[model samples]
Target: MITRVRSELTRYLRTETVGGALLLIAAAVALIWVNSPWGASYQTMVDTSLAIPALHLDLTLADWTKDGLLAIFFFVAGLELKREFVVGELADPRRAALPIIAAVGGVVVPAAIALAVGHGAPGMDNGWAIPVATDIAFALAVLAMTGSRIPVSARVFLLSLAVVDDLLAIILIAVLFTASLSLLWLGAAVACCVAWGLAQKYRLHTPLFYIPVALICWYALHEAGIHPTLAGVALGLLTRVRKDPGERTAPATHLEHVVQPISAGFCVPLFALFASGVPLNTAVLGSLFTDRLALAIVLGLLLGKTIGIFGVSWLAIRLGVAKRPVGLEYRDMFALSVLGAIGFTVSLLVAELALADVGAETIELAKAAVLVTSMAASVLGSALLLRRGRVHQARRDADQLPQGEGSTK
Candidate 1:
């Protein structure tokens, strides 16, 4: 019975739709709970602090979710990214260029728009980074549900684009958010990463060997004043992706399979629960439009992402710089570009980090913008995808019809 239950849980967590649904549900519950009469309890729980003197860690429940749990998500992302570069869609330079360029364009244009709109606004310097990421799980979930009739290559293109998009966002987080750096702790973190790589090379496959090293690396980074999440990415990239003869799977692949369920099922949803509890009173709602920073985030996501992704992709194909995915027309690409605007997960993190010094009210408004913009992007993207699906379905049905059956009728 225990084995069966474990099997069932793994299966559910592995489903893309289930993970996305759970994330949304968690965010919704947070919104409702925080706005209800018992809202104070929600804040109290999130604010409850736990200290680890041995590790020199003191963080609230919310900080733990953001700084600690989210690292697991990034680790999984790192594994997928390494696999893609080694063997997946991004393995070949020719096949990789389109998504890479599109990802860059997606990042740059939204940032430019944000800067243009929110110039001189408080926290605009860092807050402009908020809309540059595409949430892989959320975007893939929407695609899986609505793009059933779309060609398989479209999904591949989306996946590749998102992976590169996330890499850029992680780099930005590491570079832009570090307030101070301690070389001693940074050296310790680097040594731990090297140790992890050595373990992989030596074929040490036990979790007992890795969990402690990973924790130490995370703590080292935390003490170094770097975002500890970078430790997860480093460890992930260090994991071996190549399989030896007679091996069933590469170490990276195995780790991803083991860790993905935990990241999706628990870590991300729990983060959403704590991070998404923004107050939505009349003033806050009004402020979403009136506040320049909030307005910039919303516009950057809704307009900037679409224009950046689709516009660059179109130009790249026209100039013969990159090839479009097979079976994907410009219309389908536009839909995918719209889907790219769903920047929920990383955007929320950036909103918090960028505005940590700005004030709680500004942070709340920024998060509200992210949530609203993501919802709008999802609806718009889904509508476009469903329409495209219907068109493709009609074409497929017509092609399958008996020859001359309806001709001249």
Candidate 2:
């Protein structure tokens, strides 16, 4: 049994993409169930009351999934963000320019666009951050379908871009999204996080020591008026692992290996089920487009993502901060830009926060908007990527032809 578990673990670690696909599947299932005849049952199940006698904690299953399970997902995201900044492509300042610039542009533009559409509308301005994220799972899936013909630089560029986008979104949530503050608890949370950081700096050999501290930090932040999700990022950045490929392995990498799967496989999917579930009655949804929530979400994602990512990427290449990816041009990247608009995981989370206390009707419309735009962006972007691959292949084939054999000249 142990051996079988080991084998499965090894396989899953190697194929990280499967975890992402599972997340998508979970989201799809939630969407279907919510819109089905049994939708009320699904809602009831998620909304059922639950309590932990030991901890004196009480929340609906759905809230627990979103606030609790999703924290683990963000924790993993934080680790990935840290890993990238430490040694990945993002580690290099020069190589990082194109993606960073594109990410900046992508985030700002969508936010501005969302703001423009919903300006002066009640509770509308709060949702500007919804469209600024790029779902790594969906982006990677799209890239994989393009085959090996796409240059490695392009893939690296996209990955780096997404990481940067996540970073921005995290900050936005911490700053723009939070409404109140609890200074006393906030200080306690910071202190705990600081102690964790000191442990890493001193090469603390034990990972277990950080767990209790992290829990305290989570609760402290929760009470401190900071969004609890920020705690994940704090812990992730504080944990460092050094990789010594030949002789020894790094502590951070080892921890990440264990943590990443849990985050990707279990935490992220469960979070999606909770966060992304929204029931839609056609009659109700038809009127949603006119609402501030729906319009902000839809336009923010569709317009902000494309212009922000591609526009800045082009400028970066032109300004010589970074070179364009080999065999990929402005047009190819534009397609990838669209793909970045599929903001399933993060968008919904932000939407929940944005629509907080806004009433059930408003939240429903926001969810619908996210659902519609995510689907549209995915389909259109995938088609463009596939088409681009065909064009690239045709060009390659023509180049390989016998000298003067197929030349029109």
Candidate 3:
């Protein structure tokens, strides 16, 4: 019975729909809990402090969820990214150019919109990055649910686009958020990364060796004033993605299979629970419109993402720089671009980090903006997807019908 239960649990964790549902449920719980009569208790729980003095580590429950647990999510992202670059859709420059260009447009346009709208606003310096990421799990979940009739290549396009989007977001985080630099700790982190790469090269497969090294590298990055989650990305990219002769699976694929469940089932939902507890009071709701920072985020997500992704993609195809995915028309690409605007996970992280130095009220407003915009994008994208899906479904049905049966009619 225990073995059976374990197998079922693993299956549930591996399902993207389940993972996405859990993420949405966690965020909803956070919102409701924070706005409840016992809202103060929610804040207290998030603020509860923990420390490891020997390691010079101290943080609140919220910090741990954001900075520590979320690393697992990023690690899984890095693994997907490496696999794609090595052997997936991104392996071919012809197939990769479209998503790569579209991902850049997705990032650049939203940031430009945010900067233009929020000029001189408090926290606008870094808060413009809030809409620059695409949540892979959530976006993929929505696609899986709504776009079943869409071509298989549409899913591949979205996946490749999201992977590149995440890579850009990670780069922005490392560049925009690091306020101080410690050379010694930075060197230590680099050394640990080198050791990790060597372990992969020499085929060291033991978790016992890797677990400690990963921890030390994470701590070193923290001490060096770089986000510790970058350690996850570095290690994931360094992992070997190619299989040896007689090997069952490549290390990257195997690791993704193992760690993805943990990241999706636990790490992301926990982080959402902690990071998404923004107060939705009347003032906060009003400020979502009145506050420049909030308005920038909303518009950046809704308008900028759509325009950037679709516009650049159209240009690319027209100019013969890239071709659209198989069986996906311009309208379908537009819907996919709207789906790209569902910027939940990394967007929330950026909201927190970008507004960290600002007051709590500002931070809450930013997070609320992210939640609101992401939901809007999801709804709008789903509508577009369902419409496009019906079109494709009808086409498929017609093609599958008996030959010339409707000609007389």
Candidate 4:
């Protein structure tokens, strides 16, 4: 089970490794389009509405990226989480405790920082959740660039932290960002989810059979005034993660293989393209430093994420609440914490929701801050990891030296 999980994760990391580069390209294109004289055309495309009158699915292209496409992304997340809990490393309580506890610290401290900064500016406090996200693909892509001297423990630690962090972000979205609920639609979503669960119990493996089930959940959640991407989470957890006795592969394992390409290659890059494209001008550029919202976002993602993630993780170890994985050092964990601060896609999503009522100007400033801070976080993390990787490599070479021959020099 562990080997299979590792294989799946390696494949995922590879996809994200490339997807991160593509995501950057897509975001750059969007930014250029929106800032060009044809910028109005980009806005028009995002605002343009598409509807399936029969299914009652009506949304702008931008909305589809969030509600429709991101659902697939979250579904993949759900599958991996369930797999981990069932048969992967997280099945062991001791193994799971470190990342989960540390993830809590990561979420809380960043929000506290954002809250502190935002409190002085009335109406800016609602965006506390904006800094609580980690852009998994982008962060992993940066890690992938660090080369082979990086420890396996570091990969596992970062992956574990990211999973738990994302889970917290999802809860924050559900609890704080959701406006009002329609019980009828919410109940309908539950019913569809229940039916999906039963299908899993029955080991129904066909996508044709379950795709409609997923759509019903998505549609219901949309009508319930909840984010429809959550429907993916629901269905993903319901999928079987273990093969039956004598059975070959888990349904979830198979589904992940099928869905990953679609989510990584198409969904996420498309979402980044639509969501990123904030028009930059003298006024917008100037507002980043002038506005409290921008300051909150910048500080929260930069200083807050590092402090929150590393402090909590270190405290957990010191308090004996969690044990460090072998080969992982405090500084290595700190490097991972810095990478955890790359709150790109999810951070932007939260900014949109957190600033939905604040005004267009506030939204744009928050978005710009998220973009700039994510890049800054990436650079900072890379510098640390690069230094560490070289030191690690040197130590490895010295260890390979025979009979301390190099010490004579």
Candidate 5:
């Protein structure tokens, strides 16, 4: 059972690794398209409207990417998180402590730095959450690319920390960003969630039965002005994580396996393509140096995330609340935390929400900052990992040898 779970996780990480590369390609395409002579066409494409007023669904393509497609990504995340809590590492208090602490530090410290740096600056304070997120796909991609010999334990830590960080981001989106609440729609969404849970409880595993309920939940949440992605998280959390010995897989695990590909391959890249096309006008470039928003965001992501996650994790270890995983070292933790600083997917969404009241130019500037900062983090993390990777590879080689094979030889 343990081997099977490990194999499944390895498969999932490989999928995400490939997806990260695709995400980069998609972002590059968007950049080129936006800067190309047909830049107007690129703008038109995202702004294009798709509305079903009868269903209270009136949204641009960009809106659908953020609120609709991104839900799949969150759903997979929710499933992974549920599995960890139910039957995975997080169920072990010792294993769970460090990542949980690191995740909290990663969120709070970056937010503090962002708030402090952007103090009294319009829209800067509001966008504090922008630096609080970690792009799991991109971070894992860099890890995969940079360190073939990296320990499985390190990967586990990354996923765990990311899961907690994502949960925090979800809470922020729900609480801090929500403008108004529609009680009727909110109640409807809750009812749909309850019905979905009951269906799962009764062994109604048919996609036909669950899909409609899920969509209704998503629609209701959207109408309530809450981020519709929460529907995925709610449904995912409701799904059963444990299976009978006679059963092949739990509903939650099965659902995650089915949807993860869709999330990694389709939803995320689509969102990146739409969300990452910031214009490079001279005015924006000139404003970048003058604005506090970009600097605060960049520093928060690049510096604050590393300090927060690594520092808190070290503290946890020192306090005996947690122990370092086998085969990982101090530098490895620092490098991993640096990789965690690459915030893009949720960060971009937050950027949009944060600057809603600001001008279009301000919003664009913020998005540009996210793109720049994510790249910088990626490069810095890869550099750190490149050195760390050699150390780990040598350790692995020594471990793989026969007894006394390489000792003093």
Candidate 6:
């Protein structure tokens, strides 16, 4: 059994597309089970009490998944982001411009829409940043399930857009969601982060030094009223390997090869189960349509995201600041814009923070709205992409044929 498990793990580690698909499937099953008739039992199992001696820690499974497992996901995300900036497409200014502009426009328009929709409502204004995120795992999962029929350029575009969207989400979380600031703790976190960077400069290949420093950073950031996970990003960037385009075998790739699959295959799937699965009830269903919080989230996700991503992307292409991707027309871009509307994971995370002090009813309502909007976006975007793929293939085939052959025949 152990050997079989190891073999499966090895296979998953080698392919990004396959590993991502499996994780997503696990997440989907978890979601369905969480909302099913047996959901209460599942919730109970997750919420059962447990205590850790010496550490003075006691929390439910769900809480641990959110605060603990999700931190690892964020850390991996930070690592990937750092890697991209150092050696990937983001290293080129011209190639990066379209996604950067699209990300900014994506964020701004959603926030504005949320603010407009949620205006004058108590506590709703603070949640305007909630819908600006793009859940890369879920978005990528959608594309993966649809197979290679989709263009490679579209996938690359989606990835770049998601990366920028993540950066924007982290910024919004820092600037908007923070409750209070502690300069002393913030300073400590910064110093530790700087030390980590220096350690990297000294070619500290061992992972030991980074672990302790990372814990300190996490604690300090927690004390500073910033979410503890932001420290994961900070430490990740500090320890991230910055290489020239051609650098050969290094610790960075080694670590990615070792850690990324584990994080994605295990931590991410667990997070999906824990973070996304919420018990559905009348209150949740009712709030999906009526509550100020739910309404803002739904509108921001469904309407705000589509309009923002498509509108700014179109403007960029038209203004010559960015060229349209080869083989991807405006129609395809619009479909991808709809895919950007799938805001499940981060939306739920933000919902937790936004309604932390509120009743469970409010939180449940917000969750339902997120689920609905995310599902809608995924379905609509997939249909449009599949249709566009057929069209593109037909055009390509037509272009490849010898001129006048059809008329002569």
Give the C-alpha miss distance for residue 193 in model 2, angstroms: 1.5
lDDT of 4 by residue, 249-339 (tens): 8899888887877788788899999998898898887877878878888898888889988998899899998888777789888888999
Error of 5 at 304 (Å): 1.0
lDDT of 2 by residue, 334-364 (tens): 9889988988778888888877777777777
Model 3 CA deviation exceeding 4 Å by range: 404-409
Give each model's whole-structure lDDT: 0.94, 0.79, 0.93, 0.85, 0.88, 0.77
Which 10-residue window of candidate 2 scores lowest in summed lDDT?
241-250
Model 6, span 1-409: residue lDDT tens: 9999987786666465665566557667777888787888777877876666555557678766666666766776777677767787677777778888888888899889889888876557567877899888778777766635657888878888987898789877788778899999899989988988898787776668877888788768867878877886676666556654555655566566666777678777776676666666776777677877678889998899999989999999899998777777889888888989988777778887777777666676777788778889989988987888788788778887866686788
Task: Give lDDT: candidate 5, residue 105.
Answer: 97
Inter-residue clash pairs, candidate 3 = none
| Tens-place lDDT digits, model 1, residues 105-157 | 89999999999999999999899999999999999999988998999998999
RMSD of each: 1.8, 3.2, 1.6, 4.2, 4.1, 3.2
lDDT of 6: 0.77
lDDT of 4: 0.85
Counted clashes in each candidate structure = 0, 4, 0, 0, 0, 0
Instruction: List TM-scores for all candidates, in order.
Output: 0.98, 0.91, 0.98, 0.93, 0.93, 0.89
Off by over 4 Å in 6: 1-37, 49-58, 242-248, 281-283, 403-409
- Error (Å) of candidate 1 at residue 286 is 1.1
Model 4 spans > 4 angstroms off: 1-14, 120-125, 403-409
Compared with the true structure, what per-residue lDDT tens digits does model 5 show for residues 1-409?
9999967755663476788988898899999999999999999999999999888678999999999999988988888888998898898988998899999999999999989888888897578888999998888888888866777788899989999899999999999887899999999999998898898777787889899898989989988989899998888888889996788999987887778777887899999999999997887766666788887888889889999999999998989989897778999999999999899899999999888898888889998888988998999899988998888887867877865675757
Model 1 pairs in collision: none
**Candidate 1: lDDT over CA atoms?**
0.94
